[model samples]
Target: MMSITYRLPQVRNLVTAFPGPKSAELATRRKAAIAAGVASSLPVYAADADGGVILDVDGNSLVDLGSGIAVTTVGASNPGVVAAVQEAVTHFTHTCFMIAPYEGYVAVAEKLIEHTPGDHAKKVALFNSGAEAVENAVKIARIATKRQAIVVFDHAYHGRTNLTMAMTAKVMPYKQGFGPFAGEVYRVPMSYPYRDPEGLTGAEAAARALLLVEKQVGAENVAAVVIEPILGEGGFVVPAEGFLPALSAWCTANGAVFIADEIQSGFARTGAWFACDHEGVVPDLMTVAKGLAGGMPLSGVVGRAELMDASHASGLGGTYGGNPVACAASVAAFEAVEELRLLERARHIEGLIRQELGDLVGAGVVGELRGRGAMMALEFVKPGTSEPNPDAAKAVAGACLAEGVLILTCGTFGNIVRLLPPLVIGDDLLTDALGVLKKEILAAG
Candidate 1:
């Protein structure tokens, strides 16, 4: 593979103390201006980012391991994406696809159809966020199936909207005080091998979930079964091997739309274009965002032709659904994925991460190391026990940040530290980040 250049120096250079004077000022401003509900993982404010480094307002160059929550797989400031956005702005920014359509929107839809799983006839409807894409997918499924019930798994995170909040499983932050959630959204158990009872096979886990669906919410009344192929915010839990296939088959047999929320796991973040490709399980509808438009805000629901067209004309669109600039950026992102061979890159990263961090799991600091390709995680657990160790997770993250590496912690119990480094991250930078993470994990434990 050929080496790629970055605009910023790809090194973890702490010019000043972590959260230096400039970032401290920004934090003060943020406290007065930004809402308390909004939170930032790291306090430092970014001035520029490229490849694997984020140059903060304090001029501290920190290694980027979270990829801005998995949005910049191609790189934070990929040359192609930057140029595409610039060109698009010159032509015109927004016309709102509902009023006046543009070629970029249609072009993106074509790319979705060609790349997404299955050879079935498909159509696309663009949106502005992952939440919007998920909501629309549910809408389309409900309209087409003439059913109201939507089935989701435990440890699932669809989005932050009213309906998605109902779909989400965690209660403390995502759902607490956000009452009167949308009705008919049923939650079933997920196939969590690490936490499941001993000797429980993937097929057995599927049966357990299926039994609940049939007994609690009759299969006939179900409109859709929405799940993240690899649970994203829910700890990057890779479901047992046969679990996904069983659910897909059940949805097909029971006449329910199987929707894959690949918002964080899609594009080339995983070794495949989509996580469902791993199991050869094709979803009826797939919600995509995050990595879709490089760093631009864009999302979409790509699904079977008939179901996508079920909604009446003008029934599904937002004022900024398919922004032309976002679409252009998305086109460039798609090109980068192909031209840069990110699928192979992601696989290579998977090997490196596992080889580097697998020891922590054996040492009892990390309970499990799971996920695919560039989207792996380390679940912190109490020593020699399966109990969650959120304190360890927190400590490791803070320590990494103090040392000029950026890592993110997540999970229902917030005991998992997820690794989402840019696929274009340099080998040297990634190794340095992992070394910091390793030292911190050991110290925290």
Candidate 2:
């Protein structure tokens, strides 16, 4: 069992209604100071968080099912991460790894090599966020393959940067009004088992996508084939079995780097070191973030040695690519996962969530219960039909929040309520949160 050392109480307590006076006042102030485009799902203002509970300014402790969007797998205030960050800060903050190399950066790279999929000689490049890691991954692939075209899957979300926005599938929020995206970024069909045509096997799905790739953009011109092993923003959509392996094989044969964007699914979130490990699919390049540093902003691209080294000297780096504090936190985060055996915890959480929500499917309150390990989701749909019921999703999330549980919703159609509870959450707290989720989901019906 993971040791819980944070001061914040683990229990969910609703001392006042959700978003009480203090939080409502803060929301008003935030509206005045913050940009209109930026949005928050819940109105509650977090004062402190630990383990599975986020203490709001109004003295309400909300069960944190979202885990800061899956960035806090080891918990929001893991003791190891806190100690490491503090210690690293006392020594020095930033020397900019590019200007003067540091041991923390190298150490993080080494750890990533050991943890990410594949046993082959691999190299790593650190970055500040998932978007930066993805951008750098594409850059590396393009330079290494000497090609310009990059292939992305339908409903894939790479990031918010210019190039990544171009690669992303959604339009209304991510890409709308951001015109003239990066060139030569092609999109192909994804193996979304729930949404794909009936009876399409994983190999068949790969063939369909490959046929499109061959017909439209010659495989020779493709630099990278980027995909989320288990789609994150795309509704936690786990593709059909063998889909990843087929894609990997195709990329190897076609000279296109298979980039697994395991930003949300990495770091033992999917009951494994990485989701790609589930299918024995070793990606040529893997971009990771989110759970890397126990809520610290750090991302990296670990890949085969040749592809990483193909870049010219000083071609890949940023001033804060590998900050010492973030690196230290990342090292501690990895240790916490290992020490706590979070992979098994994630699987345990998955089993609990599936068992708790299983009845909703038969009741017509859920369309699908999908995803792996701690990264599970409930796709709300119109009762007795496959059509998306985004309203039901919204209702369920609102009901959960009102009752002191924080859940997040995501999907191409916005009908998925993804559950990403901290792996260190106590069994009692997890069960209680799931109970709240179940009540709200059924009530929505």
Candidate 3:
């Protein structure tokens, strides 16, 4: 391992307003060029970022807690990632790995085989986004299994694309008018422990779900059962222990593929290399993106060699499937994660979150504190019931943004607040961000 140094100076704000004058002017112009209804979570624009801090274009500096939706675990504006991306861009931006074939892309694929969970022989196919990785995964699964029905769990968010919209469970924003979705998609109940019936353990849920799948779709008809190791948009739902293992076992026996959507949970997000690694249950195929290339547009499908080879030659690939510049950044990100022991750092983040925020479940501010490692969330609820408190959750996020900390909310119920901080965040910086969150929660009620 080699030592890497990066600088992140927190410059004081000179303007009275958070966004100041310049950002406001830019926001007005943004509405003209961007699509209608498009919005941003963090209003304050970033002029620069390094490590755990965000330097706003308004000259306001704040500690970044969201890590751009868990994309920059090695930290925003990472020195190594920057250097590697710079060098690759200088050489050649894009020849498309599928066409010209570049080492940078090959390097990323090699890392995926080396780092992604499972000791089995695996192959990788690159893509542009998590959704792309997911869409491509389904294509491969259907091609391999010769089955049309793709089974996805309820409350899952595969993507915003047409096919994925049909797979996505949310109705309000993701799938309201975006009708006439892709065919052959089936939805099933997710193993949500917080709201599940009493007396039903994780294993029980698996049995029930398996029985349902067997009954409705018929195991042979289903191509693949797509799952998030820890459910992402479904409020960071951590299925009961043994639940995922049982599901994977059922898939294996039934001859249906288990596709772990680790887009949000993979690449050392949840304390482990992959959330499935915690249980030692490997998926037949997996979708990865989010933090794959330190914020560049890069995703991939890594699966058993035979399964991946199932697709006929030239059946899988994209024009920009493996952009060289993005692949270069991915190499740096992987090296940083390995050398910095980010897996251990993620565990420490889990401890801090469970301590400060998890304690609030009893205080009525939190109904559920679920998830693993850096990929944790707190669900707000009206006291003494399972009813969601979406307003309170939204308020908490709003207050955090006002204080210059960005937090994201998810869940089909829209009552869960999630944290996806950088893996390289300092102990004090992380503790302070958590303290800010605690204060807002306490003040909300």
lDDT of each: 0.94, 0.92, 0.86
- TM-score between model 1 and native: 0.99
Q: After TM-score superposition, what is the CA distance of residue 283 in candidate 3 from its true location, in Å?
A: 0.4
The residue-by-residue lDDT of candidate 1 on 225-311, one tens digit each, is 999999999999999999999999999999999999999999989999999999999999999999999999999999999999999
Query: CA shift at 319, candidate 3, in angstroms?
Result: 0.6
Error of 2 at 203 (Å): 0.5
Ranking by TM-score: 1, 2, 3
Q: Residue by residue across 79-143, what tens digits does model 3's lDDT show?
A: 88989999988889988776789898788889999887788999999999999999999998998
- For lDDT, candidate 2 versus 3, the one ahead is 2
Error of 3 at 10 (Å): 5.4
Question: TM-scores for all candidates?
Answer: 0.99, 0.99, 0.97
Ranking by lDDT: 1, 2, 3
Clashing pairs in 2: none
Query: Which runs in model 3 stand beyond 4 Å of their true positions?
Result: 1-5, 10-15
